[model samples]
Target chain A: MLEVKGLMVFYENALAVNDLSLKVQAGQVVGVIGSNSAGKTTLMNTLSGLILDQRIKELRKGGERITIMGKVIHEGQDISDMPAYERVRLGIVLCRERHPVFPDSTVLENLAIAGHLRSKVEVAQTTELCFDLFPNLTRWRRRKAGFLSGGEQQMLAIGMALVVRPRLLLLDEPLLGLSPAMQEKVVEAIRSVREKTGVTIVIAEQFARPILPMLDFGYVIENGMLTLTGSGRDLMENPEVKSAYFGL
Target chain B: MAAQDTSKQVTRRRERLDRGIKVRSEDIYALNSWREALYLLAPRALPVVALVLLQLLAPEYWQRVLISTTVFALLAISWDLAASSGMVCLGQALFFGVGAYLAGIMNHYLGLPPGLTLPLATLGGGVICTVLLLPVLRLRGIYFAMFTLILPLMIERIIEATKVFGGTEGLSGLTPFSHPLWESFLTMTALWVALFGLRRIMASDYGLVLKGINDNDRAVMSAALNIYRYKAQALFLASATGAFAGAFMTHSYRFVGMPVFALDYSILPIASAAVGGLGTLAGPALGAFILVPLSEMLRGLGGLRIVIYAVLLVVFTVGLPEGVFHYLRRKYTQFERWTEVGK
Candidate 1:
């Protein structure tokens, strides 16, 4: 289980996530749905501790001053100030938005690189599970990740994250540029991932129609503020969600 | 998400905003107040005032150093200009040496005075350099930089082997300026003109295309603008400035030698640009002024001069990677204050 308390992120004077908070129960596929620039990526980055690295880098370059004021409590421990790599060791893995895989590396190598912290047996088991979950990736195991199509790359991005054996898996915009058919496939992959591994997953996405059906609990964010929070079916049936996200 | 026990948190962030005067002076309203006018004029006027003071007051040895500093400043400005247009020149000395040799040939062979030779070499060197590099204008980034790096060295070898224009001994007793004041005034004038002139050009629409070429040549090409032509023009402008420095230095020393193509000529300008800040014309000039004087001051250390210089360069680069000019400019324009978040 993970709990975010009064999380506030600011890039210079612009408030990204303003006093926003959310929680995820173990094995729950929680969704933080928001439109573009609604701080969805910021929330995801903060949750995975990637923002800490970004903050330090921007600070050193005197570019942007990122101020984060919040507590990220993971299973009763305060991981608010923990570095991203340290958080990764604690099984918090983030598959960043836009299908970021090692472009030059083979699909197999990309998965192996992600499993550096895991035991050989555990890695092999997870690798097998990833290939089983996304058969599209198994066909291009030896091919460079860069040469694969966008949908295939997204699948590989997910497979790479899964290889880490993450207890809390954060996928930021997993279905970003994928077509409708590809979106259905990815949605199905997420469904089977939960059924098989039972990992606590947090998916931040703008495409609500494909994702909403599967989320146990969903938070609808607008301009860094939580506008609505309800059960998946409750959200799907809501008029406002239907108008804004579903484009009904 | 009821009352969580997060009461112990103190949220504060440093906020940076432009100074009122900087914002005021950025527009036509700067003439409204003396304060804004002074703020606008001060940075621009400081160099002119300093140059006049140095001309009138500095010792003879320092005057020579000042001349050399200005020349190096000119070279740095040229380097910055080329770099801004996406040509990362590693052989600024190619432009320098070509101008030096041209001036030397004119003075030694044709018997032209310093006045004619300086102008001739400056413009001729720019044209020659542009033509020489026209073949490789298509190469971007490191490939272009590598070509430039190898050129001066290749030229140096060619001159040595061919034994042209005084060969390795070089042309001596060619021409000296009438007075040190004239030399100082000439170099300083050229330095400021290049700095301010290029800065003004870069702020124009013409400079936008040059910058676009650097940012994304493909995008600029899609806009139907000939990026190579703009790049060549930028190269000519940059090379002209460099050539002027080389030509001026030849007149000052009363000699033009193979050392004109030395790696120091190439490397020092880049080092100055890095220390001062790249992209900004004035930054490179400021950097050259700082570095050349610093190098002169460190002359007593002999073997350890370079060691201390390298250490200081490292410290400046590591401590303030944005460069001193940028850091100072930011401080001057912006004011920062710590404020409580969510208040």
Candidate 2:
């Protein structure tokens, strides 16, 4: 479970996440749906504590100042100031947008690199589970992750996160730049991932049509502020959601 | 209780904003007033005025140091130009040596004066250097850097072995400039011309192509531009400035030797560029002015001179990785103030 309270993020003078807050229950699929520049990535980064790393790096380079003001309570423990790697140890893993993978590394190597903290047996078990969840990846296990198709890379990215055995998996725009068929495949994979492991998943996406039906609860964000929150079925049928997200 | 406590706390962050004059002067129409015009010209004109004043007031020995400082400054500008265009050159000495030799040969063998030899050597040395480096132009990143690093050393060895161009003894007793004032004046003028000229060129459309080549050559190529041709031109332009410095130095010292190809000629420019800032033409030149004089001042420390200099370089690079020029530029153009968060 996660609780974000009055979370505000500023990149210089620009308020990226403006007093936004959300809550996620254990074993639930929560969707933070928003279009581009709606601070989805910023929210995801804040939750995974990756923004702390970015904040320090930007400060060192005299670049854009990143100011985060809020508390990220993970099951009642304040992790707002925690570093990314420490957050990872707390079983919070983030699959960053655009399916970023080591271009030179094979799919197996990429997964192995993500599972460094776990035992060989645990890694091996998760590797098999990932292959089961997304069968498309099993064939490309030996191929370089770079050589894989965008859809395959997306699946591999999720599988790589799974290798870490994350208690909370944050998928940031998994369907970005994927075809309709690929989106369906990724959507199916997410469904099976939750059904099998009952892992609490937080998916931030602009593609509301594919993601909305699967979300246990959904939050609609615009310009860093939450406008609506409801169950999946309720949001799917809502007139405002249909007009804005579904283009009905 | 906890929610009330959190709500009561206030947080502040420093916000940087461009000065109103800077924002106004950015547009052509808004420069209607004399004050705005002066504001724009002051940062540019003040440095030139200061350099002239320093040369006029300094003693004879320091006057000579000023000339050498300009030479290094020219090389730093050239280095920064080449780097901005994606060709990271490690052989500034290659340009310096070739130009020195060309000028020396013109003066010694052909009996030419300093006036004629300087121009000829600069152009000829640039062409020759471009031709020599053309073969390795396609090599990107460290490969190109390694080739550049090896070049001056290779030329040094060849000169030593073949005994061509006076070999180890080097060409001496060359013609000196007409006057120290003329030499210093000419060098300073070239430094300003090259600095401003290169800055103007980089801001132009042609400079955009060169920058595009550096940023993403493939993207530039996709736009139907020949990156190689652009790169060669940028190389020629950069090498010419470096060569001019070398040719002028040859006459300044009244000698040309293997020391022209020394690592100090190559490294000091790079250090100046790094310390001052990269990309900005004036930044590296300013860096040269700061570093060269700093090195001269440190000469009084004897053996510890180099140790202290190296430590300062490390400190500047590590502590202020963005370089001093960028920091100063930001402060001059923008003001920062604390503002309440979530307002």
Candidate 3:
């Protein structure tokens, strides 16, 4: 389970996330849905403690000053000030947007690099699970991740998150730039992930139509403020959600 | 989630904003007020006044030091110009040596005066250097840098082996400036002209194209502009300034030798630019001013001079990576204050 309390992020004078908060229960597929510039990525970065690293770097380079005011509690532990790597050790893994992979490394190597902290047997089991869940990746296990198509890269990114054996996997814009068919395949992969492993997942996406059907609970954020929160079925039927997200 | 408890904890963040004078001076309306007008003129004017005073008042040895400093400053300016156009030139001495040799040849063989030789060498040396480097213009980043780095060394070897233009002995007792004041005046004139002229050019549309090339040559190429031609023009302009420094130094020393192509000429300019700041034309000049004097002051340390000098460079680079000018500029233009947030 994860809880965010009064999470406010500021890049210099610009209010990126303005006093926004949300929570995810264990084994629940939680969706934080927002359009572009809606602070979805900022929220994900804050939750994963990447903003801390960014803040220090910007400070060193005398660039934009980033300020965060919030308490990120993971299973009742205050992880607000935790570093990104330590948060990763705590099983809070974030598959950042844009399908980031080691462009020079093959798919197998990327997965192997991700699971460096795990035992050999555990890595082997997860690698098998990754290949099983995404059969499209099986043939290209030795191919460079850069050469893989965008959809394949997206799947590989998710598989990479899985390789880390994350307790809380945060997917930031997982369906970004993907075709409709690819979206369905990724949505299906998420469903199977939860059904088989029961991993708690938080997906921040702008495309609500494909993702809303899978989320047990969803929060609609606009301009870093939570606009709506309801169950998947409830949100799917809601006229406001339909008009705003589906362009009904 | 309840908001009442969160509202109780109000956090304060430090906010930075430009000073009123800086903002006001950004507009032509600032000309109405003397304070804003003075603010605009001060940073530009102070340097001119300081350099004049330094030349006139400093002791004889320091005055001689000032000439060499000016030479280095001119070279640093040239380096900054080349770097601004996306060319990381590592062989400024190529421009220097070419101009020195050309000026030395004209004065010795053709019976030319300092006046004729300086101008001829400055322009001629630039053309020669540009032609020499033209073949390698297609290379980018470190490739270009590596090519430029080897050129002066290669030329030095060729001249030594071929035994041309007096070879290692070089051309000596060629000419001297009529007066130290005249020499100081001429070098200062060249320095200011190059500094202000390049700054003006960079602020223009042509400079924008050059900067665009630096940012993304592909994007500039897509816009139907010939980036290579623009890069060559920038190279010529940069090399001309470097050549002028070399030509001037030859007459000042009354000698043009293999030492003209030494690594110190190439490396010192870069170090000055790094310490003073890159991109800004004035920053590199300021860097040369600081570094040259600092090197002189550290002369008492004898062998430790280089060690202390290097340590200071590392300290400056690590502690204030933004460079002193940028840091001071920021302090001058902006003010920061802590303000409450989340309420």
Task: Please tell me which predicted candidate would have the highest DockQ against the true structure.
Answer: 2
Q: Compare the candidates by TM-score and give the number of the best one.
A: 2
Candidates' lDDT values, in order? 0.91, 0.91, 0.91
Per-prediction count of colliding residue pairs? 0, 0, 0
- Using DockQ as the measure, name the better of candidate 1 and candidate 2: 2
Positional deviation of A185 in candidate 2, in angstroms?
A: 1.2
Candidate 1 CAPRI classification by DockQ: acceptable
Local error of candidate 2 at residue B112 (angstroms): 2.2
* Candidate 1 C-alpha lDDT tens digits along A1-248: 99998888899888898788788999999999899999999999999999999998887666788989878999999999999999999999999999999999999999999899988898899999999999988889999999999999999999989999899999999999999999999999989998998899999999999999999999988898888888888889989999998788
lDDT of 2 by residue, A1-248 (tens): 89998888989889888777788999999999998999999999999999999998888777898989878999999999999999999999999999988879999999999899999999999999999999998988899899999999999999989899999999999999999999999999999999988899999999999999999998888898788889888889988889999999
Residues A109-220, model 3: lDDT tens digits: 9999999989889988999999989999999999999999999999999999999999999999999999999999999998998888899999999999999999999988
Docking class of 3: acceptable
Which digits, one per residue and each the tens of the lDDT, describe model 2 over residues B243-307? 99999998988888888999998999999988888888888898898889999999999999999
Estimate, for each residue in B1-343, the C-alpha lDDT of model 3 and write its tens digit: 2222345677899998889989988879778899999998999899898889999999999999998999999999999999999999999999999999999999989989999999999999889999999999899999999999999999999999998988999999998989889999999999999999999999999999988888899999999999999999999999999999999998999998899999999999999988888888888998999899999999999999999999999988788777777778888899899999854
Q: Which stretches of candidate 2 lie over 4 Å from their true place?
A: B1-10, B29-31
Ranking according to lDDT, highest score first = 3, 1, 2
In candidate 1, how many Å is residue A124 off?
Answer: 5.2
Task: For all candidates, state DockQ relative to the true structure.
Answer: 0.36, 0.40, 0.36
Q: Candidate 1: lDDT of B294?
A: 96
lDDT of 1 by residue, B112-165 (tens): 999999999999999999999999999999999999999999999998999988
Error of 3 at A232 (Å): 3.2
